[model samples]
Target chain A: MKTTTVFTIGRQFGSGGRSVGRRLAEKLEIPFYDRELIALAAKESGLSETLFENADEKATSSLFYSMVMGTYPLGGGAIAGRSEMPLNDQLFLIQSKTIHALAEKGSCVIVGRCADYVLRDLPNVLNIFIHARMPERIKRAIENYGEDEKKAESVCIKKDKQRANFYNYYSDRKWDQSETYDLTLDSGVLGLEGSVDLIIAYDEMFRKTEGKKRMVST
Target chain B: MKTTTVFTIGRQFGSGGRSVGRRLAEKLEIPFYDRELIALAAKESGLSETLFENADEKATSSLFYSMVMGTYPLGGGAIAGRSEMPLNDQLFLIQSKTIHALAEKGSCVIVGRCADYVLRDLPNVLNIFIHARMPERIKRAIENYGEDEKKAESVCIKKDKQRANFYNYYSDRKWDQSETYDLTLDSGVLGLEGSVDLIIAYDEMFRKTEGKKRMVST
Candidate 1:
């Protein structure tokens, strides 16, 4: 094998990001995780699987808003118990741990759950963000989410906001910023297959370059 | 020569976007415009060059804020004359016209000034957004903008906000959003030369594909 390259994808809703990730993993013969990671986190955290799903890519935004407005009690200070801590935070920690564990296990593709931020310290990981122009996403939503155009766009926008908020809250870096990821591709232009091919090519080029660097150092 | 390819780049502040645009223009042997567009707009609008520079990528945000707050003089009605309209709107129109005129003239690279939004309707246009990670952008600011690290980050963030607001207010599409462009690359990942080369390759690929499409259609 050339190398075990890990990939983390951050993407806009309805952009066929998960589809591309799955296809890439298949083409690359690697494990793929999207909702599957949520399952693993649930298993790791010993929490109800439903809890993770409910909080998937979305924290308790209303609770946070109310707390900011001083309308909701925060239960306790910063030392709040695990049970007392916000559900979203608990979900994030378990998912973060699961992401690290997966990376340690082997090279694979992990989608969302802020895996880019969680595994950023690793040297072998490539973080990619996938998005399309709104019209394309709206078209994709019709196909993927089976929703009409207007509803799809609104849903897409809302989901992007929630995902951004989730990533921003948990990660030190802002979400979807160009620098946050190693590569940012508009799936709208390249299309899903092209995006997967680009990533694979990038991985090959990166590993070859790294191989040369290691040889020179040695 | 292959068909002319126009590129409009929308980028995050401190991402070395302008430099990349310049380098790409050189590599592609095409004309490049950044601040030059502002001068053209100033000429077109018969507005002071200083006004365009002052409002460059930042419409009179304070004026917009005041208008939003119902405090600014809105010139009596919605259909205000060019003389009574906000300085930002006049500048945008002139630049919009300039962008279209440039497209009609020949292929070129345009940076900022909402060029992507301005040229969105064109067939042979590639809208690329260049962004780097914050740490990388800070380093770039020191080298490119000659600012201290702390100030570089702050200025970068502030500039990004202003650019976003300027874009959001003027264009129907939102700024920095992935769907807003055809290609979004991380200059941090590919670096200047690599990014330019990538775009060239994409342009070639796009042209070949378009040739196939036109043949099939005919």
Candidate 2:
């Protein structure tokens, strides 16, 4: 079987990004994994599903610093106590393994869960972040949840903030920040299907170019 | 006549970025401006068109920072023995006027001249940056110019560095940096036509959403 490229999507809640990812995977004939990754990680790590799920895409306290010699200054030792949490390390390990497994299985679309950072240095991975205007996302949430505008608005804000917090904690970069991803799409404006089509075309082109590079080197 | 949104494209020479900008304008049925901008700036500034044309999107010391200091760093007192050139400052002023005038006239596409930074705070401006991989850009240049691969590659590298240097000098920001533009497209991967289509769609969506924002606010 030919080695396939893996696409990992990080999205804001209510942005229809998930649906876009799903459609993209279906169109490309690849597997789409979202929360399903938790189960896979659980099986691989021999930990309860919720252990991975509960920590799902949450940020851990990985302090930002550069070490001179061995000692860290500026209250670093004290903070290391809080940062050295066992649960966070275990969760990160699971997330990392799950991402690796998904890629190993061939082409797959993995949504959120620090998938981008987890597989950053991998040879054939495409990382994308999706976002949209506040109002559009709020409207989508209201429609999807069949709830009133205010409740849906709160849900949108809360969920996006959670994603941002998680991304900031684990990645050396910020979440939903366009610079972090190879491709960043305003899914709300691109319309779900159009974005999916664009990404598929982009990924195909990228892989073809990569193949040419390998052939030239050989 | 209705006002249409203006798009400013910044690109590197030999990147086929200029062709992409032209195709985009044609596809959108909007006027495309590149060298044409030089004529307009000359007319606006009451300077000889040749002077402005020769300067031609070249970098000058950043006015943004100098303005904060309440004086032009280069223009201010330096030495009595050495005479300084005011040519760039004049060109910059002229180009800025031309940009505003063009925006006022109707929707149009302006290529380079740091149009993104020129129209940075404008209400309905779309800024795009076009780039390509080194090998791809060199290939395009070779095909177009009938140059050897090595020569074409050197030309591509030299031209892009000049553009980057110019942009960074004037904007105090890195050139070809993805975060600076509303959209960044790889011309090599997307191809000129695909990029044009994608951008047209993006521009349309942006306008529709901006229209909706107005409707909601009013």
Candidate 3:
């Protein structure tokens, strides 16, 4: 059965979250959004793609600092009343709007960009956090991403910190905390394919439960 | 195939964790231990069952305070070198030993008492954390456990804090954190039966992956 559920994935770096999202979208025959969000946000906001890419997963204070120091440009956007906002804030707003629009359109998988928080009001959104052991994440960074072996562990740590700060700053909930999501999966233990399978199982169960709830309410 | 996998559950009060553990154990046809551990520890250590039940989930400092105030007794046990230890510590040690012994015997579902941390050295242990939202938990507390309607929420919160403190004080890892457990389930979202089904799915997947790893190693 085709589900109208939207899956929002928050993941640690090198935890195969992006890959899982992509594969899940494929299996579910739904659209997948990850880096594609940046381009979509850029298109919607009339901002440069490079600006959104650089602003991605960056905490607001750093952008504010750069804006204060006159090192960053307040890019022109088509949207009104957002010109004076920090670039990070502007990007986040546009991205959140884009995420809402995407979810409203249909069932899809969106990774990162605080889509969970953005679509918090939607009943069909399933927020998921994917994580792995530090050593396994570091190994994935080095082996899969082809990072310098010496810097892989640090890189993973840095990326996760950035994501955490970004998510925590934008959303009321803390990133990677199980309470913040509908489900949290350990990609390290489940493996990427296993994680996807588990998610599929959960999605089916979620749909069935939701169906029952709706039936009772009606 | 009859697989040997010990399931250790950490849970919030009123989250149906004990029920899930009992049902999972029955389905797996393995032994289930919750309050039963108190009796076992009492039997093994020659300490009164009341001591074990009272000392259960109480942090060490409170027991230490009682000892310093000359209110608590230093119960004699069959084990040596534990007479001088705080009652909480003694109970913890004895309970942990009981957990290790239970795990060594075969596959079993052990609930609470920091079994995940106690059996950290075991390869076939699956650490799970079960939780539910406050409203559902409070409802369950009042309806199932017959907690006072006005006091159910506070009771759930208080019990969870005690469990968290007991776990955090003894284990290197923090309780209720997703990373601490192999799987974390929201009974609030999954429902009790759904949670059990999901866990069964995960256990099967876990065993298959472990079997593959063993084959590769050999």
lDDT of 2 by residue, A15-78 (tens): 7789988998899889999988888877776667766676776655434222222352323433
Runs in model 3 deviating more than 4 A are: A62-72, A75-78, A211-218, B62-72, B75-78, B211-218
lDDT of 1 by residue, A25-49 (tens): 9998999999999999888766678
By lDDT rank, best first, the candidates go 3, 1, 2
lDDT of 1 by residue, B46-163 (tens): 6578867876887656656455346343334433455456656766787789889997788899998888777766667778888776777777789878898668888889889888
Pairs in clash, predicted candidate 2: none
TM-score of 3: 0.90
The model with the greatest TM-score is 3
RMSD of each: 7.3, 8.6, 3.7
- Scanning candidate 2 chain B in windows of ten residues, the lowest lDDT window is B209-218
Q: Per-residue error at B139 for model 3, in Å? A: 1.1
Whole-model lDDT values for every prediction: 0.74, 0.68, 0.81
Error of 1 at A129 (Å): 2.0
Cα shift from native, residue B39, model 1 (Å): 4.0
Cα TM-score per model: 0.78, 0.61, 0.90
C-alpha lDDT (0 to 100) for residue A71 of candidate 3: 42
Interface RMSD of 2: 6.3
